[model samples]
Target: MTQHPTKTPQFFLTSPSVCPYLPDQQERKVFTHLVGDRAPELNDLLTQGGFRRSANIAYRPACETCRACVSVRILAEEFAPSKNQKRVLKRNSDLVGTLYPAEPSSEQYDLFRDYLLARHAHGGMAEMSVLDYAMMVEDSFVDTRVIEYRRRGPDSFLTGEGEGELVAVALTDEMSDGLSMVYSFYDPKQEDRSLGTYLILDHVRRAREAGKPHVYLGYWVKGSRKMAYKIRFQPQEHLMPAGWERYQPD
Candidate 1:
């Protein structure tokens, strides 16, 4: 009888660094490469285990003392848009989202650059060049798609595609259970449209239509003002040591 060897993923730990979301704190990460024919399956499993994918890597916070980062996922079937979310949807009603293969474009990079410069000038991604942006969008082994949000054109109803300038872009991964939002960016000039929140709401609708139960939203740091927006999506599940449980913040 031939025996098949069990393949185990190799993980590496990063050196301690200043936490980006929290002050007076340090952060470390345990990450492994997501490659090979099994990359998609591995990504889905790791994501369900509280790991997040970046490019071809899967990483999760492994801080020594702080456990502030919590994985969150929205219950797509049960998600009800609040009054404010409804308003956001109505505001962006003229926009349409079309999913495309994982390919990079100059227009997408331009918007990404502008968003970083305006909203995250001091963040690490501020230094990303066009090439870096391409890698972020296309250097993936899993089943990934780039959804471009644009103004609805005259023929949009016929083609189911958007036209005109790209207003927002979401890099997402299709998993067995749900859609995992890897990263997203939007035109800062359209702040009143609340494009960020609208993107999440759209994903929930997309997931529900695809028969998916959840929409992974990455980590929600408890004390980070920037991360506080994630909690606004109610009826979400927070991955806990016990298991994923309902989280309704007070």
Candidate 2:
């Protein structure tokens, strides 16, 4: 077998642990360091192949006898928001998004804490500390950015932006093929707004406006309510044996 120099790249596997989404299934991941000149290319490929990046590592769920986690990418250029999607867009009309370097701020941390407590208090990321949040946002080799969504103020007409508290944020990775939404959080209190869906919609717009064809949305695990939402973005591509194939809702 022809071996690439990356074969020996630092590798490790997580000990069997409780799966956050599944009731009784345990989960584990085998990961490798994503560095060197090929890191960007590898990261993009990994993302398409159903892996997610954390800090400097790109890893995927390698559960025994399980293939439930599927990678999904939104075809941004071809995206046409459904009637409900349009509602989500109009719902957050008062907000403006600013793209900034992937640096964590105390304000961001506070919002993150509130989000976890309200939405995923029982999930894996609930115990993450402020420093952990910083590493999650700041530790990266490939280009990363933070989009902060706030309310519009008086100068909103000139800037079309807001000066109110940050209501939502997305940590994204800029790739050659698309913008990978690494992670996103929003004010959970505004349940009526469905801000999570709004962020995904916004990224779809940003990706299309930037001339990118796809918006990587990480993995969508079967039967996982937390991930089922990814499937709603129609005309997306799901990685399969023959490579990315279009997935249209039934």
Candidate 3:
């Protein structure tokens, strides 16, 4: 065997695991590290190429027989919140969002654990310990931020940060064209407000306010209700063979 450069990117495959979105299905992922010298630029390019980052690894669903994982990005300037989206906005009007460094707090971990236990009890991440949570939040080579969501207090208007308990959290990345929402979780108990959708909507606004052009919404797995909500944020773009293609949903 010939010696090779250690800097050359190496990819690895994860053993088959239970698929979270589909029942009786197994999922496998092929991933590579997104670190070293060019992480930020690599992240932006891979994002356009349909990859999402978890920790410092950039990956997409690499299922052999399935092509359900389609990457979705919102045309932030052209996006119009539907009536239902507006309703969600109205319902969550009392919540405030604050962006901070990618450092984990016990408060956040409590909400995260509760979100997993209450909402994804049987999910793989259900067993993630606080150390695991810290690794999730802190492992990154590119710019990443955690946006904390909380209910507004009576005096919040007078100050800025709210007083209510944390209700949602979005681990997001600031990209060249927009902000990519890597993952988001919310208080399942507040199901009526649709906090997840509200979080994405808030990111779109944040992207626009920051003068970004789109909001990368990771993967939209067909027939997965968990991923389907991504479509309603139109006019959106989907990665196509020819390149980014604008689409109108039925």
**Highest lDDT scorer:** 1
Rank by lDDT, descending?
1, 2, 3
What CA root-mean-square deviation does each model show from the true structure?
Answer: 3.8, 3.8, 3.6
Q: For model 1, how does the per-residue alpha-carbon lDDT over 1-250 read when each residue is reduced to its tens digit?
A: 1122226678999999999999999999999888777889999999999999998889999999999999999999999999999999999999999999999999999999999999999998999999888989898888999999999999999999888999999999999999999999999999999999999999999999999999999999998999999999989999999989999688
- Alpha carbon deviation, residue 11, candidate 2 (Å): 3.3
197 in model 1: Cα distance from truth in Å? Answer: 0.1
Q: Give candidate 2's error at residue 53 in angstroms.
A: 1.0
Higher-TM-score candidate of 1 and 3: 1
**Tens-place lDDT digits, model 3, residues 84-152:** 999999998999888899999999999898899988898778999998888888888789999988889
Per-residue lDDT tens digits for candidate 2, residues 137-241, read 987777889999999788978975669889999999998888999989989888999899999999999999989999998888889988989998987999887
Deviation from truth (RMSD, Å), model 2: 3.8
Error of 2 at 152 (Å): 1.6
TM-score of each: 0.97, 0.92, 0.91
Weakest lDDT window of 10 consecutive positions for candidate 2: 1-10
Candidate 2 off by > 4 Å: 1-8
